[model samples]
Target: MTAASSEAVAGAVSPLGRAGRGPHFRRREKAWGYAFVAPALLLFAVMGVYTIAYGFTLSFARWNGFSPRWIWVGLENYIDLLGGSPVYGPPVRAAALNTLWVMIAVPLLTVAVSFPLAVILNSVTRLRTVLRSVYFIPYVTNGIAIYFAWQYIYEPNGAINGVLGALGLGSLQQPQGFLGNPATALPALIVVMVWTAVPVAMLLYLAGLQAIDPALLEAAKIDGAGWWRTNRSVVWPLLTGTTAIVVLLNLRDALQGFQVFLIATNGGPGDATNVLGLETYRLAFLSELAPTLGLASALGWMLFLVALVIALVNQRMLRRLR
Candidate 1:
């Protein structure tokens, strides 16, 4: 046989088979696969790559995002953000603190609230799919619609206030928006965030629960363990890795919670709810606060770093569980 025929024979050992067709057909298959994937890769690079490069470039300059050009000033944005410039100092510090709070509280709250619901959902018999869909509806709803509904519900003379008034608890009036109260605003957004996120976590946990062998639960029962004891001793121990994954995913989701807060409170009633996401947004786009593109890029990269670290730690813990 010719050199080409011999090469075709070797390549045809693949599952696709047949030396006669191997070289041309295999290359054709690969070409088609690449063609099919090209659009997605192109879209990903266009949407993600440009922004990342631009943001990084901006972080090293004073480009308020509007002006035609930027003047490079290396690390000035970082310095200004970290309290070097008195103008940008205080808000940056406060925004960092707020970001930290949301990061901690929102994920923890979602895990705590959703895990039990997941357990219950897994246990359901009748109307299981219907019930799961009901719980998941809020997650799929338009966020804008939810924000408006919440605005009405939290209004002084709205449902919440009306209920409080009828119960002789006085009206739940704050005069200013719920976003107005420094003490309550951040925590309030945390609640909305956790609530919206719980359904997804619940679904994930339920999938994990189903993968767990029923025989394990049965064995625990035969050992004279009650329901709670079986869950604690048998169910939960096996669920550690799942829980860790859930936490990691939830943390990633919570980290990007700017839009939820923006829609609900617009990061306002005076910056009470202004986390790093909102702060970066305002710096990058809002107002004429001397667009510190470099600082904004730094903020973007900081978010990326925080997310990366948490994800890495999560992977480590998951491996240890195995």
Candidate 2:
């Protein structure tokens, strides 16, 4: 065969030359299909994967976030963080306490408020939609704007204290408006966080309530169960999934409570309200004023690991609930 004839002969036996695909050819096509996802894989690696790896790598370094002074210090940063660096820095113990307090307060307050509201909303007939919207208004409201507005209300002579004075509840001239008082500091943030969370959790419970079969409720009533008994025996069991989801979601958000912490306290009134998230941000970026980048990075990874562990526990609880 000549060159052109030889080429034509190979083409004739090639996959393209075949009329139909066999198993081997289909497997090869599927193998090539995986190549189409390569761009997404590459994008994720660069955007997400690389940044995480680089951040953790920076934790051991003794450099500012910028500049080329990135010298590795072996486990020094971790040692100082774990073992306590009395002379050079504040120990991480205080931040950990603040975080624990916020975490507990947020979830407890959220569940306490939202669950009752959800139950009442479920029981009532008229204006349910309006009530839900009213409750949910804060969730859609801008947190930054709310904080600034609330910040004023929290000021010494602001409207809240004014209300207290008008009601003869004692003037807040001693100047404690949920923001400054050491007692109220963490609880105030927890209250705002809980207020924002309720609408969402109430909505979840409402969904669960709606999902309940009306026929079952009626059957329970006919079988001599009162409304309260019917709800406990029939409705409550059905709502377990949504309850689990709401509790876990609320817990997760509360544990990660940064926005409220940052806005409400700025970790203030003498570090009385410092959650781990705020501490991490302050150390890493805020400390850029003095620039303790390595310390900040170490703090950040610590917070990340804590959050990851909480998330895992949340997921495990959710699974176990099923």
Candidate 3:
């Protein structure tokens, strides 16, 4: 047989070449798939997995973040953060408690405000979309700008104090600003966090409201269920899943996010607003003495474990509710 006939014979006999998918074709297809995904995989491996692994490893070592020598301290950093060292223990414990306070307060307040707001928005027959946009605008807007605006509003003579003065309630005003006072700093930040978080939670609740069966609502009305009763009995239970999601997202953000705290208070007013994430950042980079990357990593890992346990417990509780 000639070369072409021999080639045809080989193609017909080979399993891969039987359907016109030769070895070269299969290899090329795989190569193209890898080519499309290689960048993303490489990025995730390096930025996500590798960094987490390295950070975990660094947690057990003692390093100042600039030294080449990493002294292996085993659990010294963890013990110090958990209250072994006087210098680091008190602040770390306080920061952890503050973080827990935020995590609890923000989510509960966000749910309380957002669910009602969503119900009100959903009830509106006119300008519904506009109202939603108005509420959601804060979530989409520049966070730094919003924080600054809120800072001004919380200022000694800014909008809030001005309003209080106009209403003849001047005694309610903070002369050093709400954020400037240790008594009010964390609560003020919680208010802003809830304000920013409300829109998203409301949006999610709106979706849940729409997903609710209209027949159930009609039945509740037929049974003489008023607005409050209807919402409490018929609507709230139905939105448990949505509530769980909103709670979890806000909880995670409150636990991990510190930008608002950084900009608004910088964990100041005598560490009243200091949280775990901010404490970690401060330890790693903004320490008055040497930057303790190892202790920061240990604290971060502890925070992660705390978040995990809380999330799991939350999930179970919410699931039971559902």
Candidate 4:
């Protein structure tokens, strides 16, 4: 080939040369990327991968937290939990159901309450920042503090009952106390869960609302669409991503949330408020209860599996919606 033709052929074969980099530079870039990610990978290996593996292994063995001897039970604990062993099986099933109830109720309630508030906040031109801050205070506040406050409010002679009594609706007052009655305890706890969850959901929705094109809403208005029609037709469709996020977060929280129940009800009034998370804690740590670390680990795995399934389902539903 001629010199000109040789040069053109070499250029055609070597795109990286034209870009001022080659295989060596690319290798170095990759090395730097790995170097940057090394710490995070190490942390995940130690904290996530190793722990998960160990926990799963532990679930098949009997061990108190400090015991060096781990007796291999080989599905005995699983049988006790699932194979109709009356002692452990009933509480486990009940707690699982309660957790499911909370997971369903809290997220739906949070979204239903937060969405309209977010819409209003998005439309406001005055004191919007202040109102948002006020709403978000509960999210940032200490959870235990909120639990105690709500506990007082649910007391028989507390502010809620006081107000009802003064309104001459004395019969409406919960003399047994909201948390003291089995019929009301779980629902009351759900109310508190919804209350704490709404602020975060509201913030997420506000962001989603702001990201929407204002011109679309204006066009809808020009087409003689009212508030409900505009939101139902335009806003709701656009906020699907935000809704998915909100639902996942709320579901995870409700499934794993134990602290609120620990402080507020302690799964009291005849296991009325019992849930898997709290039950796990009880089995693992509470001295008054049986220290069944293996059982607790099993429960933890069960919870993890349930959460994983729900997340996958949520993703699939979101994909279908899109």
List runs of model 4 lying over 4 Å from the truth. 1-44, 287-291
Give lDDT tens digits, candidate 4, residues 1-322: 8998987777768865544376777888899999999999999999999999999998998888777789999888888878557878888889988998998899999999999999999999999999999999989999999999999999987888899989999987899898998999999999999999999999999999999989999999999999999999999989988999999999999999899899998899889999999989988887354448998898898889989998999999888988
Which pairs of residues have clashing backbones in candidate 1?
58-293, 58-294, 59-293, 59-294, 60-294, 64-291
Ten residues in a row with the worst lDDT in model 4? 15-24
- Give the TM-scores of the predictions, in the order they appear: 0.84, 0.81, 0.92, 0.85
Instruction: Give the Cα-based TM-score of candidate 2 against the true structure.
Output: 0.81
- Which number leads on TM-score? 3
**Residue 316 lDDT in model 4?**
92
Estimate, for each residue in 28-107, the C-alpha lDDT of model 1 and write its tens digit.
98999999999999998888998677777777877666678888888877787778989788988888888888888887
Candidate 3: misplaced stretches above 4 Å?
Answer: 1-19, 318-322
Ordering by TM-score: 3, 4, 1, 2
lDDT of 3 by residue, 1-322 (tens): 8999998899889866656696788888999999999999999999999999999999999788778889999999999999999999999989988988998999999999999999999999999999999999999999999999999999998898999999999889899999989999999999999999999999999999998999999999999999999999999989988988999999899999999999999998999999999999999999875658899899999889978987999889887886
Q: What overall lDDT goes with each candidate model? A: 0.80, 0.76, 0.93, 0.90
Candidate with maximal lDDT: 3
Q: Candidate 2's residue-wise lDDT over 1-322, tens digit each?
A: 7998887787678866443366777888888887898889999999999988888888888776678678888778877777557732463677778777767776677766776678889988999889888988999999898887777877778877788888888744437667889877776677677777888988887888888788998899899999779877888777777776776677667555588778777888888888777776777777634446777788788767777887788788778877
Off by over 4 Å in 2: 1-39, 87-91, 171-176, 219-234, 288-291
RMSD of 2: 5.7
Q: Candidate 2: worst 10 consecutive residues by lDDT?
A: 83-92
Clashes of 3: 0
